[model samples]
Each structure stands twice: as C-alpha cells, then as structure tokens.
Target: MLAVHFDKPGGPENLYLKEVPKPSPREGEVLLKVAASALNRADLLQRQGQYDAPPGASSILGLEASGYVAELGPGCQGHWKPGDSAMALLPGGGQAQYVTVPEGLLMPIPVGLTLTQAAAIPEAWLTAFQLLHFSGNVQAGDSVLIHAGSSGVGTAAIQLTRMAGAIPLVTAGSQHKLQMAEKLGAAAGFNYKEDDFSEATLKFTRGAGVNLILDCIGGSYWEKNVNCLALDGHWVLYGLMGGATISGPLLWKLLFKRGSLITTLLRPRDKKYKQMLVKAFTEQVLPHFSTEDPQRLLPVLDRVYPITEIQEAHVYMETNRNVGKIVLNLSQ
Candidate 1:
C-alpha cells in the first residue's frame, strides 16, 4: 500500500508517497479500501511539526475518508459487512490506500452521494456538529457567530445552525466567501479583514449580542468575541489559527458577560465519545443529505485532486484559496 509520508515534518515539499505496509483490522475494527480523503488545517499543522497524532494513532495526514469495507475484525458487531460503502472520522491514516477504523466510527454513505462527496464529511461535519450541539449547546432562536465562515466546518455549521432554528452569523476574509456563507444559510456575513465583525454582529442582532460563538481564531479575536457575546453566552474554542497568547483582560470581560469559555478537540477525544457523536449525527443529521428538501444538507467541495498531487493540495490549502474541502482521490 502507498501512504503519504514525511521524513522530518516541515513543509508540503516533504510530503511524498512511500510503499508502506497495508494496515490490518484489529478487534472491533474494519479494514477499509479507501477511495478518497479530505484535507484539514490539522494536516498542515501536523506537517509543520505543530500537531502530533493522538497516542497509538496512525501518523499519516488525513483525518477523514470514504471507502469500502474490505474486512472486519473479531468482536465487530454484525452491523457492517464486506464491500459495504462507508465513510469515517479517523484519528489519522485516511490518506493511505488501506486504513483500519473502529467499526463504531463508520457511517454508511448517504444516498445519492458519491465517494468523493462522502469523503468530505466525517471530520468537518462531525466537528461542526460537536461544536454547535455538544460543546456550545446551541438553542433554537439563538444567534451563533461562526468564524472562518467559508471553511469546511464553517459551511457545515451554517447549515446545522439553520436546521436547529438558530440564526447563523459568519466572518470571512473576502466578499465572495461572505456571499458563499450567506447562500449556505447564514443570516449575515462580515468581512473580518475589512470590517469589525464583532460590531457588525452586534448590529445584526440589534445590539443584543450572539448567544454562542464558534471561534477558531484565538487571542487575536478575544476582545471582539467577548464584546459580541450575549449574557451567559458560550464561547467554544477549537482552534488557534491566530496566535494563542492574550495581552488583555480576557477573563475580566468574559466574567462581566457571565460567558462560559469552553475548549474542545475532537481528534484526541476517547473512542466512546466519538462513537456517541457519530451515532447521534447519523441518526439526527445524515438523512437530511439524502432528502428532497430544498434546504437539505450538502458537503461543500472546493477541489478534488489525485493523491499524487498531495503537495499541491497542501499548497492550495495553505493559500486559503478553498471555500470548502480539498479532497484527494485515493482510487486514482
């Protein structure tokens, strides 16, 4: 099997395909014949020696993939069989041709979606679902501000927020990205590079402030996030795209608003938790993607590159040129 490899983590230039041993399924696991994998910011970080894979996880770059079940290991429940089409949220190794996954983490591909589209789900959708529901505790009628509004998780969050009857606000760097976000169901979108998003959010809500904030930018947006948070709002921090250090009275401002600061990382979470999240998402959200409803969920895809172009894909993502996911076709 060929897997994406890097000798010393540094840049996309270091990424290459090497003939590595195919992974085998362990107890309660399934060996998937991967067809496609999707890119994420975490992949770039891991490549740059910033993020490490979870303990005992595969060191390969991908965090999500779509494939067919090739084999099932012992103690696996009878829920899946060989040749079943599935997609999964992986800790790592999805970029490889063959990767093992816990059977519990596998989801049947939604009807009418190709393997390429399903490949874009798992990590992005699951993370968005987790942030909006599990971590943020979003409620109907709530106003939620999602940063990086055109991102994979951001697009997913917009739709999910609308599904929950919440008002979704977003911040992107360009007018085109902002328009894309609004088309996906955001009540309003702001240009973070040109406008004061916090002020815009406050104005959009008529100065009422947002009930929840999905913040990927850390210290750089702390004051602004606190400014737009409603009384008792939830601020969920899942990424640090900006710097991590704060120079202001973050605690003081948040305290004044009675805001709750919550931090979460899905990749490092226990298997049981991921299984629970997958089950909930499958039951509650998966069907929407297959429905005829005009507003049914969709996985936004920016581009599909052959696995051989992994370096180029990374370069594209690093430039922040994608409005959604950048997929790697493993079947090619």
Candidate 2:
C-alpha cells in the first residue's frame, strides 16, 4: 500500500508517496479498500508538526474516506459485508489504499453520489453538523454567523443552518466565495478583507447580533465575534487559522455579553462520542443527500487530484484558493 508520508514536519514539498504496510481491521472494525479521500487544514497542520494525531490513531494523514468493505472484524454487528459501498469518518489513515475503521463510524454512500463526492462528506459535513446542532445548540429563527463561508465545513454549515430554520450569515475574503456561500443558503455574506464582518453581521440582523457563531479563525476574530454575538449567544471555536495568541480582555468582553465560548475538535474525541454523533447524523441528515429528496443536500467539491499527487493537493489547499472540499482520488 502506498501512503502519503513526510520525512520531516514542514511544507507540502515534503509529502511523498511511500510504500507502507496495509492496515487490517480490528475487533468491531471494518477493513476498507479506499477509493477516495479528502484533504483538510488539519492535514497541513499535522505535516508542519503543529498538530499531532490522537493516541492510538493512525499516523497517516486523512480524516475521511469513501471505499468498499474488504473485511469485517470479529464482534462487529452484521451491518456491513464485503463489497458494501461505504464512507467513513476516520481519526486518521484514509490516505492509503487500505485502512481500518470502526463499524459504527461507517455510513452508506448517499444514493446517486460517486466515490469522490462521498469522500468529501464525512469530516466536513459531520463537523458542521456537530457544531451547529450539538455545540451551538442552534434553534429555529436564530441567526448564525459562519466564518470561511465557502470552505468545506463552512459550506456545509450554511446549508445545515438553513435546514434548522435559522438564518446563516457568512464571511469570506473574495466576492466569488461569497457568491458561492449565498448559493448554498447563506442569508447574507460579508467580505472580511474589505469590511468588518462583525459590523456587517450586526447590520444584517438589524443591530440585534447573531444568536450563534461558527468561528474557525480564532484569536484574530475574538473581539469581532463577541461584538456581533447576541445576548447569551453560543460561539463554537473549531480552528485557529488566524493564530492563537490573545492579548486582551477576551474574558471580560465575552462575560459582558453573557456569551458561551465552546471549543471542540472531532478528530480527538473518544470513539464512543464519535459513534453517538455518527448515529445521530445518519438518522437526522444522511437521507437528505439522496436523490429522492427534491432539495437534496450537496457535498461541495472544489478539486479532485490523484493520490500520487499528494504534494500538489496539499499545495493547492495551502493556497486558500478552493471554495469547497479538495478530494484525493485514491482509486487512480
């Protein structure tokens, strides 16, 4: 099996395909023959030695994959069999041709979706779902602000927010990205580079502020986030793209608004918690992706690259030029 490997923690140029032993299924797990996988910001961080894989997780780089069931481990329920098409939410190791996954974390590929498309679903969609429903406790009539609105998780968040009957406001750096977000159900879009998104958000809500915020850019946006958070609003922090150092009265301002600052990371969570989330997401959201639905959910894709071009894929993601998920076609 060939997997993406890095000799040292550094840039995308360090990434290369190396022959590695294929992983086998463990108890209650399934061996998947991966067809496609997706790239994420975490992958870039891990490559740069900024983030480490959780204890007992694969050291390899992908967090999600779409594949066919190859084998099932003992103690696994009879939910899947060899050759079943499935996509998995992984802690790591989806970049290779073969990887093992806990049976409970596997989801059936939505009807009418290709393997490359399904590959984009697990991590981004699940993260957005968890952020909006679980962490943010979003409610109908609520106004939610999603940063990086055209990003994989951000795009998913916009749609999910609308589904919950909440208004979704987004901030993107470019006009094209803002347009993409609007098409995906964002009620309003803000250009963070040209305008203060907090003020734009407040203006969009008629000076009432947003009821919830999905913040991926931490530190730099801390003050802005609080400024536009409604009273008792929830602010879910899942990433720190803009740096992590805070030098001011962050606590005082949040306290003033009675805001709740909740931080979460799906990759490092316990398996039981992931299983529960997967089950809930499968029941509540997976069906909408099927073609049978008139307004089916969409898994936005920006680019697809062959697994052999892992370095180029990473470079592309680093450019911050993508509007949606960047997929790696492992089958190629």
Candidate 3:
C-alpha cells in the first residue's frame, strides 16, 4: 500500500507518497481498496500539525474515501462482499491504498453515483446534513443561512437545505460561486466581502432574522451569526476557517435573542453519536437519491489530481480556486 505521509508538519510540500503496510481489518472492521479521497480544510490543519487524529485513530491523514471492500473482519454482517462499492467517513488513514474501517461507518454507494463521486459525499454531505437537520432542527418553510456557499460542505448544504423545504441563504466570495450555489438550490446569495451578512440576513428575513445558521467560518461570523438569528433560533458551529473565539457580550446578546449556540467536531464526537448520524444519513437521506443517475446524487468535482499531486491539490484548495470537491484519484 502507498500513502501520503509527513515526517514534519508544514504545508503541502510536506506531503509525500510512500509505501506503507496495508492495514488489516480488526474485529467488526473491514478493509477497503481506496479509489478516491477528497481534501478538506482539516487535512490542511493536519498537515501543519495543528490537528491531531482522534485517540486510537490512524496517523494517516484522510477523512473520507470511496472504495471497494477487499476484506471483512469477524463479527461483521449484512449483505456485503469483496468488490462492493462503498463510501465512508474515517477519522484518518483514507490516503492509503488500503485502509481498515469500522463496518458501522461505511455505507453502500448510493444509487446513481460512482465510487469516486461517492468519496466526495461521506464527510461533506454528512457534515452538512447533520448541521442542517440534527443541529439546526430545520422545518419546512423555515429560513437558514450557510457560509462558504461554494465549498464542498457548502454545496451539500445548499442541496440539503432545499430538500428540507428551508430557504437557503448563502455567502460566497465571488458571484460565480454564488451562481453555482443558486443552481444547486440556494434561494439567495451574498458576497461576503461586499455586504454585511448579518444586516443582509435580517433584511432578507424582513427583520425577523433566520431560523437557523450553519456557520463554518468562525471569528467575526460568530458575532454576526448571533445578530442574524431569529428568537429561539439555533446556530450550529462546525468549523473556524477564519478564527475561533466567543465573546461574553456576544453570549449575553444571544441570550437576549434566545439563541442557542451548538458546536460539534465530527472526528471527536462519540462513536455512538457518529453511529446515530450515520444511521440518520442512511435511513432519511440516502433513500432520496434520484433513480436516474449519480449526477443528482452527488456534485461533480472541479478537479481530480493524482495522489502524487497532492501538493497541487492543497495549493488549489488554499486559493479557493475550485468549486465542489477536489479529489485524489489513486488510479492516476
């Protein structure tokens, strides 16, 4: 097996494809032959030593992958065998050609999707789904705001928000990104650089504010998110791309608005919690895939770089030059 490993944490330059021992499945686990893996901001943090794998997780740095089952461990059940196409959200180790995963975390590839595209869904879509449905407690006709509307998570957020019958308001850096979000079901888009999102969100809601907010960029958005929430609304914080800090006065003001601040980290979340999320995604959302083909099941990637070109992929993501997921194709 080959994997992207780093001896010293730094930038993309630190990533190198190296031969490593193939991981074998343990009890209740399964081994996968990785076809594709996608990059995330967390991968960047891991590369720079800012993030560490969860306790007992692999030191290898990939969070999601699409692959085929190569081996199954003892105590696993259900209808599965060698060559079953599947996608999974892993805490790490997805960068390798062969990695072991807990059977509970893997899901059969949704109908109408290729293994590569399926790789793009597990982490981003799961995160978006959890944020909008589980944390936000969205209801039909409710209003929601999502930041980073062109990100992988952002793209998934737009689609899930629409599916739940909620109006999705998005903030992206460019009009092209905003347009992309609109095509994906976002009802409104804002240029975060040019507009004050908090003011815009309130105005868009006719001064009532939104019922929920899915915030990936923290820092200033934290304060503005508080200002943009309707009374008793929930704000789900999933990432801090900008910064991570919460002010006392902000908490006081949120108390006034009856806003509840909820934060979650997928990797560190309890296994039972993640299992619940995986179950929810499988039962409630996976069944909705269009019967026609996979394009509707998952968005197309803007770029696919070989595992050897991981550096370039990281650079592209840092520049935010790509829309949708940027995946590493092991076949290349």
- Please name the candidate that would achieve the greatest lDDT relative to the true structure: 1
Residues 24-45, model 3: lDDT tens digits: 8888889999999988888999
Sort the candidates on lDDT, descending order: 1, 2, 3
Q: Write the per-residue lDDT of candidate 2 for residues 73-134, one digit (tens) a residue.
A: 99999999999999999999999999999999999999999999999999999999999998
On a 0 to 1 TM-score scale, where does candidate 3 land against the true structure? 0.96
Residue-level lDDT of model 1, residues 1-332, one tens digit each, is: 99999999898999999999998899999999999999999999999999999999999989999999999999998999999999999999999999999999999998889999999999999999999999999999999999999999999999999999999999999999999999999999999999999999989999989999999998899999999999999999999998899998999999999999999999999999999999999999999999575668999999999999999999999999799999999996
Model 3: colliding residue pairs: 112-294
Give candidate 2's error at residue 75 in angstroms. Answer: 1.2
Steric collisions counted per model: 0, 0, 1
Looking at candidate 2, the ten consecutive residues that score lowest on lDDT are 198-207
Position 244, candidate 1: lDDT: 98
Q: Judged by lDDT against the true structure, how good is candidate 2?
A: 0.95
- Estimate the Cα RMSD of every predicted model relative to the unseen true structure: 0.7, 0.7, 1.7
Write down the lDDT of every candidate, Cα atoms only. 0.96, 0.95, 0.86
Q: Which of 1 and 3 is ahead in lDDT?
A: 1
